[model samples]
Target: MRVLAFLDGTLGDPSQPYVRVDNTGVLRGDGIFETVLVVDGKPRELGPHLDRLAKSAAMLDLPEPDLELWEQAAQQVIDNWEGSSEIAVKLVATRGSEGDPDAEPFGYALGMEIDEKVKRARTEGIGVVTLDRGFGPDVAERAPWLLLGAKTLSYAVNLAALREAGRRGADDVIFTATDGSVLEGPTSTVLVAKGRTLYTPPPTVGILPGTTQRSVFRAAEAAGWTVKMEPVPGGELAMADGVFLASSVRKVTRVHTLDGVALADSTAVHAELCEAYEAQYA
Candidate 1:
């Protein structure tokens, strides 16, 4: 792992602990983050990631992100990382110590090799189980403090959901709203295909906007596949011709089984989208 911690206007080592104990981000999980895939020393979809990071920071009322500094830190980390064909560059910003709410936000960028499990999931479709998120589709609009759309550092619940799925003998989870509307995976966006048309749940459902999903939709559209964003019921997964969990690190990964029921063979669509996804980075 290679990391570049941003201090004032300079970068420091991340392996060394630099965060103070009183930091609000550490104490209360008050922070925002973005993960980008770095290939050939270049962070893919960097602009989109930074834009989303800024939006998340704004939602949290943190200091405006200094994109130039973040970019510099990311480049430094990428340059330092060795032999990792697909490195994950994570940019994070945290609210400073609780005592000083006006203090500058702490920020850092880290680069590390992709996990072997994630790589295997990309090639071998994963089994997913649906878990209820216990929220309604209109929660984000009705309750701003919930921070539904922001990619905050408070991922305890998400992690627990994945663990629950693992306990159920599934590889991942797709969260659903109280009304049984399929929202998204713990760390990915949900995509379903029926013939040549691709469907994804809209952000209006209180899910985070997916940068990778947007890129894949664009590529799919160019390849003569129709793309649409609408509410997907939990039962729809069983009826779709194919289903996938798309993310920056995982790319486009097929979901072989949903709740122990095998989905229609998506080998052809998976191959098509995988090629389209790789071409974007190529």
Candidate 2:
């Protein structure tokens, strides 16, 4: 039950070829994208995702995204998605035909069912291994052209890290900065809980800001929990009361292990985190 819709209002089956053969997005990976979780029929945190998408476009020196058109297209795809109450929709904007110099920029939205394993991790939790990210926390500010915080279409390194995790018999990864600072997961943001407080690394340290994490923190604050953004050390994750990874599809997922070492069961703590995250939808 996958669906796709173009900005021009064309709706079609995603399996059918649509994008131009020489599209620069496919040839050079020159683009930006966002993954939005659609529950029931509403897209979760659509505004923040679109704002980040625009910020990514600015970082790449591309034209500003047509948010109105994209919103219409994304909603159209969501409306057509069948059989899944929980769907993951991707909105991709790219430089058009590489062979056509005068080609205008174009984009589309595609909707599909979320993977069963990702949903399972929401409850059963995931095991993670820490790997050095090969750069200090200040790299993003020092080297802005590297696009460190942008959600670009290129994710080869992130995908490779997941493969390495599999090789090491781990389910996922929590990347640490070269200076032993906790950065984020390949596809998620890291949050460590300590008693009645929660901490997450600031996005200024070179990670994409997590839309889901922001809402969770707000919900936590409303529930009388202290929330702070700081530079989290890798060791802090191991010693924290609970470690969670936040993402759109997975929401708040508990990190059950680190480097094959079993972490203490923090189910009660994570249950609160889940409730806070889910509060936005309510």
Candidate 3:
């Protein structure tokens, strides 16, 4: 991953030692983050991403980040990179361990170039498996420290779930509730299309409210289709016309096979959704 790190208004290589001291984000994973897609040199769904980042920070009790400063940092990096049509920018706000130790916050922005092959997964599709149920529906709803809806730096478990899925010959994992209800994928939102209606697990159901999914829904409506959000059963995905994992990097990719069962290749829905988002974002 080619990376550009911003420290105190200066952009430099991430290999440099310019990270501010006493960053709780590195020390204790005490930070909130948002990943956004930049296409044709403009960030997509910027308003919603910032809103969600603010909410996540509030949920974690972190200080408010300077949104304009972060936006300038992103613009600096975006303007410098030439010929790169698309990339993913990660904005993070860390509770700086400076001054009063309980006062203002510090944070940084990181931008990386994502491979075209990865984004092309929208057309090629992916495979998914179910991880061992560690964060179930009931537990996530009741656990006060669960950070169920926050996109924080505590991503060890998310990476682990993806690793376990790969070990099982899958590209990702769809976490299931203890009672067998569907939750979400490791780093993406699950979208299953049944006819013209697109369904996704609701945010109340232990899933991150995805920005890409929001844009896709808007574009879907523009294309004359209805969208539904409710409890999604894991089994229901297999019976749908098509299944997709939506994220900033992956965009929208079909889940062609689930747990070794080959899903019928419904690339047309994939094409429609991809075109919808691309026309709007890319």
Output the number of the lDDT-best candidate. Answer: 2
Tens digits of lDDT, candidate 1, 1-282: 565656344557667888899988899999999999987877888999999999999999888898888888788787677756788888988998888857778888877678999999998999999999999988878998999999999999999999999999999999999999999999999999988999999997899999999999999998889999999888889999889999999999999999988889998899999898778777
TM-score of each: 0.97, 0.97, 0.92
lDDT of 3 by residue, 43-120 (tens): 888778888988888889886666777787777767777546776888878777644556457666677787675766
lDDT tens digits by residue: candidate 2, 15-77? 878878788898888899999999999999999999999999999988999899989999999
Ranking by TM-score: 2, 1, 3
Q: Deviation in angstroms for 58 in model 2?
A: 0.3
lDDT of every predicted structure (CA atoms): 0.89, 0.90, 0.80
What's the C-alpha lDDT at position 120 in model 2?
Answer: 94
> In model 3, what is the error at residue 274, expressed in angstroms?
1.2
- Model 3 reaches what TM-score against the true structure? 0.92
